[model samples]
Each structure stands twice: as C-alpha cells, then as structure tokens.
Target: MEGFQIIRWLSSDDTAAVYEAAGPRGRRLIYTVGHRPAEPAAEFSAWAERLRGVRHPHLAAVAAAGLTDDARPYVLCDTGSTTLAERLVHTPPGVNEVVRTTTAIADALDTAHAAGLRHGTVCPSTVVYAADGTPQLTGFDMCAPALVKTARPGLYTAPEADPGPPADVYALAATAYVALGGTLPYVGDPTDPALRLRGITELPGVPPELTGMLRTALNPDPVSRPSAALLRDALSTVEVPETVTTGALPVAVVGSDVRAVSSGMTTIIEAVTGEQPRIGREKSPPMPPGLAPTRPLPVAPPAPKPVRAKPVTSKPAKASGRRTGRRIGVAVVVLAVIAAGIGGVWLWRDQFAEATEGSSAIERVDFNAIEFTVPADNDRKVTLTGGSATSTNDDGRAESWTLTDGPVFADGNHNGDQDTAAIHLVLEVRGSKRSYVLLFTWDGRPKQAQQVVNGVCDVTDMRSAGPGIELDLVSANPFADCSALGKGDTRAETITVAMRGGFLMETAPHEGATSRCELAPGAETRAQDGDLPVRVAADAGAPELAEDIDSVTVFLPETAGQIQWHLARVTLADGTTTCGWVAAADL
Candidate 1:
C-alpha cells in the first residue's frame, strides 16, 4: 500500500481485498482494493476525489484513493475494528439498537445525498462500528458499473436499475431487517433481479410501524421509496422496546464494501467478445424490429453453484450458474451481433427505459431525433432541430438551448395509455438560465402538447408521478442569485407537474393545506401557536426537546399522523436554541 503498512489481510474476494492497515501517523485504517475495470484510472480517481469532500461523523471519510501498480482501484478509509456483518453473526440487534443505529446511518446518508452523492454499496459489510460502538458508513462511490453484479454481495440490493439514492434506502432497510433476525428475503439465482423484487418477508417481533416503513423502503418501484432524511425521521418515531445492547466480538474484523465478482461480471466480459455462432444449429425466430436485446451470450456456460446464505466474507464468492441458457447457439448469434457493433446500444441501454409490449410509443421513441421549439427574445421562437438550437442576438451575444433529459412517458392526456412525453431543456445565456419541461404527444410524430419552465433552479432528476411529472430541484443557499450557485452547493427541493384542463401545470397543495416551503437551511420563521410544544421525536407523544421558543429556523419538513412537522432549531425567549420537531400548523 502507498506509504501504508498492511497489518494483515482481513478479507479477499473476486471483487476486492480488505486489510487492516496503518496509515500516516499510525492511524488504524481499512484499505480496500476492488476489481479493476477496463476504464482508465482517471475515472476511478475522479469518483474518489468527489468522495473526499463528502464528510459526516457517521460516514467513514476516504483518507486516500488511487490505483495500485496492477491498476486495481483501492481506497483507504477511517473505520472501527469490526463490521456490522460480523456482529450480526453472533447476536441479532434488539429493536432499540436497530432504530438508533439505522437512524444515525440514514441521517449520515442524507448528508451525502444532499451533496448529490450516493452510497451505492450500502450493506452490513459497509456499516462498521467505531471504537465507541457508533456505526460509521464506508464504501462511498465504489459501485462502478463493472463491479455491480448479481445480488450476492449482500442480499439487500435494489432490484430495478443500478443503485441510486432510492436503492440505498432499500439496502439499509434490508440490513436492518437482517439485524433484527429476519431471514434473507432473496432465494434462487443470485444474479436474478426478479429475486430482489420478490418483496421482503415479514420480520417477526418488529413493531408494525417500523415494519410498514420498511415495506415502503423495499417497494419494487424506486420512485415510491422515501428519501434518506424521510426514512430517518420515520424510523425515529418507531416505538421499539428498550433492551440491552449486544456485545461486540473480541477479535477485530471488517468486511469489503465492493460487490464480489461472479457470474454477472463475466456477463459483461461476454457482451464484448468476438466469438461466432457454431454452424448447423437449429434456427430460432427473429426479434421484432425496433427492439434490442439486453444482454449477450457468454463464451461458455459456467458450472452451477449452490445458493448460500453467506455474508460477503474474506473468501471469493462462487459464481452462480450461467444465466438460464437461451438456446446455446442462439446466444452465440446474439454475441456475434454485439461483436459486430450492430447492438452497440446494449452497452449503455441495458437498463435504460425498458419499454415492453403494450407500452406507449413515447416510451420507445428516439428523443434525439425529435425537434423542439424554445423561447427566444421579443416573443420569437427558435426551432430546435436535432435536440438543440443556438441563436446570435443583434449585439452578437450567442445563446443556446439544448435538451438535457427526458422522453419521460406518462398518461398526461387522460388516456389509458402513457402517450405524453416530457423532455427537459436547459438554456445557457450569460451564465444565468433555467430549465423547461416540454411536453409532446405522438400523432404519427412528436407534436408539442405543453411547456412549463422550472423555477430558477437546477434539475437533478425527473420521473413520472402518476399522471404527472416530479422534478428534483437543487439551488444554492442564496437562491436569489442563481449564477452564484456552484456545482457543489446543494440545497434542494422537489416539485410535481400535471396536466390540468389540457395544460401542464404545477400541482398545488390540497385546499386548506400548504406545500412544504423551499426554505434554505436555518431559514427563520415565526411560530403561530406558541402553546403547542415541539417534540423530541417526530411523534406527538415524544417529550419536548426545546423550550420557550421565540422563533425557529427549519431544516427538513416531514409528515406524521397526517400533520406536517418541521425539523427545526428553536430559539428560546432567553436567547438559547435547540433542535426538535415543530408542527407546521403551529408555525
């Protein structure tokens, strides 16, 4: 290790090698070497660089990261002597311990999420307890495409697409379930995404409220999962019986954060091979036009390995059986097509917009081929051909509008099918611009249906919200000056848009209710009902954590018992301040 002494190797798997290492100043640290990808070292370094700035007390900070002499990606991080996985093997965590530990982890995750980072490999292995017994999260930014394989790394992975923030929630919930002594929900082939989506088995002895929250976190639809901050709040309110904390293992240990390489890793390698189909094999029916194959065939079928309830250990995990064979000869033909570049889209679109039969044309249409119209000066409209348009003003100042995302299909037309497509476009002018959501309908071709401008903010993500569209918006602390907002400044909020009376409009709050405010952290507001108490927890029955509040500065807003509550720092009448949950109705 670079300038570090490897005390001993803790674990070695096909995915990574974990070791107890001594870093600068003899600081005990855990070093990891994950399976290298074909991509350049700079790409891995870039991600590691990003993780360096994401700091939290509960997050294991990346001390150093780079490639080894052999080009394997390695990271040195702060950690405790043992991992959550090792602790679980002995004593299952009591309900109270699960809430406290998971809440801390979720809060830590929320901090990273706010900075636009994701802990793609969250699991028992990544959650390591500190010397004082507080868990700290490790393995940030380790889920490179090549490393993401079957569900075997840990049984707690999101089933839908590549791991994202929502996936992290699912992983945390699964980890908590296991800590509470629940059986691993997944069975059958480790590489199957369908197994992850089979729904979690009920956890005996768990509080109903906690179980319900976990159910939502494990929903097959990622969009429906709550944010890390929301989950933390909900978990805090869970009434778990207070019990003695479990004892730690005497010997030191830590688990690898990277997913172990297995059958799925080979699937990636096979996709790019140049092998040809054997001659004289029985012919199979051809795929319909416009549809593309998701994966290519392996050069050879791998031997089957029995499923095991193995926590990612110090040994290399065995590869599962070759993906249920698809007529051996037929696989060779598909691989040949991939080898010839005819299926180039398969490389990136493996999980992009999976449009199945009976889906609307909007789901399958080529967004790049559609032309659009954008606003220009003096009520003029600039026709954008090929997804972008640029114009020069009389003063010779160049302005441009380019499509950034979308073709997001939703049933905005009141029809049974999701025929309306929403595309996102960004304007670059004088370093001050906003995004627009352009809605289009297909009548033999894409036709403009409606257009809506996003409030002066950055669009981080967009997805269908029933018959509407939900946009995750991010802005700087002082949002009034959008130009000052740099890439790393990350205060954010979400908004939804829907079609009302043949026009796309921002969805309003229910009649007598107010929507969550887009207030910056520490934004001050006055309390309306001073008599109402601010509780220590989100639940109404929880003890008051703050007293004699004069005013409050709110951070995050959430709902409990159909009432809105703001997690706020309350200023007392005597000039002292403390943080607690303040009801929206009281504020």
Candidate 2:
C-alpha cells in the first residue's frame, strides 16, 4: 500500500493479509501486512533481523520488513505468485514432485535450524516455487507464539508451547501428506484450537515407504519425530513411478500472463516472455542489515531501480553485505527485448543488416533463423526455422535439434568486437540427447555459424570466458555401463572454446592450478592406510570411494586450496590404474 500498485488480495489469516502488488517498476511481489502481533515494533523488527541473517537457495528471502504507517508490521518477500496450496488445487503432485519438494524444504529447515532460528511456521501456503522450479520456504511470521497458536493451529501438529525444530519437522511431514494427494485428518475448522491432526490417511497407489517415513515424521512425540535432515535423506531413497514424474501439470499464476485454463485451476502464469518468474530481480537488492524499518517510508516516492546498458546473459556476482541474498534471473523485458530484437527479425535483409560495424551496439541475435553447418561432418548444414529442426537419417529414424538456451555474448574471434554469441542446442537421436554449442557472428546479415563442439557425455555449465566461452564437460566413466553416464558416473573438466581463424578451437579455460601439501606431479602418497577415502569428484557429495585402492600418484594442476581435493592416479591392490579425487589430509 506504500506507493505500490495493489493488484488484488491473495490470501489472509487472522494476523495479517497478503496482497499481490506491483512495485514501483511494475515488478510483481508478495506483500504481507500484520494486523496483530503479541510483541511490539521492536520485537517484530528483531525477528525480521534473524530472518534477514539466514540465507539459503530454498528460502523465500525477505526484501523489506518494517512497521506500516498504522503501526502494523509488514514484510515483502521475493517469490513466485503461486503457492503450494494453490498448486495442489490444480495438480496433485506425483511421487517425484512430493519427494523433491519434501527434500528441498527439509534441507531448508535444517539450514535454518543450524542458524539457531526456528521457522515456527511451515505450511502449504508458505512454500513457493521459483520460476526455475526451485521450491522455497516462505511465511516466516513475526507474530508471537501464543498468538500463532490461537490463530493458525493446523500449522503445528505437535502440542509444544513454543514450536521449535521438531515442530517444523512435523509440519513439513503434514504438508507433504497434503502434497501427495492425501488430505489432512482435520475434521472441522483448521484454525480451531481444539482440532488436532490424528493420523495420516494413506492414498491408494502411494508407496508404503514414503507413507511410513511421513508417519515417523508425523509422530506425536517431538522426541520420536525424525529431524529435518534425516527426513530429507530418507525421502531421497523412495522410488517414484516414471509415468507420474514425466506428466505435465497445470501451472497457476495471479497476473495477466495466464496462458491456459482448466477445470480445477483457472489460469497458468506464462510471463510476457516465455521465461518463468525468476528468483530475484536486480532492482530489489536486500535491505541493509541492522537498518530495520523503524523509520517511516520517505515522503517522496522511493528511488527507482538503476538502469542497465545491456541485458545480462549470465548470473551476476552476489553483492556483499550482512544480509546476503542471491539476486538471480534476468528480467522478462530484457529477455523479451532480446527475443524481439533477434527472434522477430532473422531474415537476411532485416533492419539489423543495415547497421555498420561501429554504428551502434549490436542487437543480441537469437539462433532460431540462423543456419548452422557442421564443418567436420562432410559440411552437413541444418537450418533452424523456429528454434528446432528435424530430419530423417539414412535409416529413416528421425533426428531433431532444438535450441534450449542462449545467445550469450562473447568476443569469440578476440578481434576486440562483441559480434559473436554462443548458442546451446540439444540434439536428440533415437531417444538420446547430446548438447552442442554453436558460435554465430552477426556482421551485417546473419553470418554462417559453426557447430564447434559436442559433449561426449553432457555439458553442465556454459559461461562467458572473457573473449571466449568456457564450459564444464562431463565425461562418462569408462568402466561403467552406458546407462551409468545418465546415473552420474562422470568427471568434470573446464575447457574454453574460442574462435580462431573463423574456426572454433578448444583450450584450457583457466591457469594456475596447484596441489595441496605442495606436492608436484609424479609424487607418491600412501592412501587408504587408515580409513582414508577417495571420491568421484572434488565435491563431498560425489559418489563414495571404492575400498580396494592401495596408493595414489599425484596429478599435475590439482584444484587449489589450503587442503584441497586433488585429482590423482589411484592404484588399486590389483595394480590397475584409474583416476579419482583424493583429499590432501588423507595423503
């Protein structure tokens, strides 16, 4: 209500009302105003401070929190308009959806608990999905505990006076129950203090393993309930039906971007551009830490977000502050402009063809109308009409290539000109997919693009590499079966691809790699001597180490760190050699 253009009331509770509002720049946001709080302004502000301090990918970050003009506490969170509650009304989540949502929220709760703050509230209404399909936990209330209990009792299945971590666990389990097409056992009014969640009702075809885990989490005894971390791990093991996971569900939104309507849910939010609602906008940076909204909003209109000269194609570096929330996703208008500038005019004689070399900034080009020729494959040419192209092979099997993402700008030729853009495409043949990167230059008309590289297994990340493009190529494990690659039996190596002499070339993306313990290549180290372990990758979550390894030989240019995980030639007891990642401490 403070200079924001209110669109409509979304949902409300006894303590506060939530509204869908467009901020000064016409960006949609979730605004909550609390009408009643057991504590005064100072207590509410302190609670908001705690929320601001904790940051996680799965947490719906608080952008602003302070008291309203009428002394009511208000909070503004960056989240998608749709809620889990609204989604359930339209799409009953499949087993995969249930597991993923449960695991993400549980991990989020565990992270919050580790920070010494209790969410104190976890419900369907509080969980939101970002544009990228990442689930986030929101609805951290500033209301006092007693007031929450008297107002929204269904949120907590446990009878604890002060809901803590255990209470959060129980609530997540209950929410999962509802998400898995199982209705809660509430008989009457959900807010009635006398009403209690008796037990979960099992849905037909739902896995007993999942139901059993929820039951354990829904245990009445706070001591008996599984911790959020444990619940997350347990859910990860449950089997999901493949058919259910692959089916599409109707998406709901609160704006004019609705694309389709069905029986249960009215509309789905498809942004003006095809992009989904991003996690955070560059305009809404996190408020300064320790600067609580104690002071009233300025009499004049709030300052508008700074303008950018060009649309950002890569994730920006996170800003530093006490409250560090990641600002992600490029704006819809920027994407729209890129699409309109490129997608709308791909003909050779379009307006972009008239611009001189230094006339103005080069409009970003989309690859939909661009023709790509694979130089190495007998000069095979494939023309993309609308981001996709299909042709029959020699054996009459249909092969297709679709442009998934891109037009990321880089000076591929390194000629001090930003004329080159990298486009990512997916090639599907016989139900198998391979990622390929195409380099195109817009001189006057669309220049002939080259299909530079194809992933032997899969390409994970692609970003600008100064005057080139860097990609993380994952190679499948040689010892494993063909399906093992899909199951993540792979290793990562960063490589840079650049345009040299009008041809794409590959080079080492980065320099200056040194091993921990100051070891050089060919150095020998005894491993597995005393419970030492080796993994598939440098990260801890990589596959667990094999048990038969006897010793390791240091490899050159290991990942740099004080105690880094180094790539080494792992020698097994049988005297065979294979490469793996080992930590410096183990050596």
| Winner by TM-score | 2
**Residue 223, candidate 2: how far off, in angstroms?**
2.4
Candidate 2: tens digits of C-alpha lDDT, residues 1-587: 23343333333345554444434322345666654542566876676667678889998776676665555676676654345654554334566887888899999998888877776667665677764668888756533332232323443345565678998898888778766666556534445434454767667667888999998898767899999999989988888774452222222211112111110111122221233332112222222233322122212111111211121111001110110001111010011112112222354423344532322133334457666553223225677877899965445667787887676565443444565566777767666665566555555544543122322354544555445565544444221222333322333334455543332334331111111122322444444542456554444544544446667655433223344555555555543334555656656
lDDT of 1 by residue, 69-184 (tens): 55666666776545566455433356688788899999999998887777777777678776567888876635642233333344566775667899999889877766766555
Candidates in order: C-alpha RMSD to true structure: 26.5, 23.8
Off by more than 4 A, model 1 = 1-3, 11-16, 24-26, 34-38, 67-72, 145-154, 188-204, 244-587
The local distance difference test score of each candidate is 0.50, 0.49
Summing lDDT over every window of 10 consecutive residues in candidate 2, give the lowest-scoring window.
Answer: 324-333
User: So what's the TM-score on candidate 1?
Assistant: 0.40
Best by the lDDT measure: 1
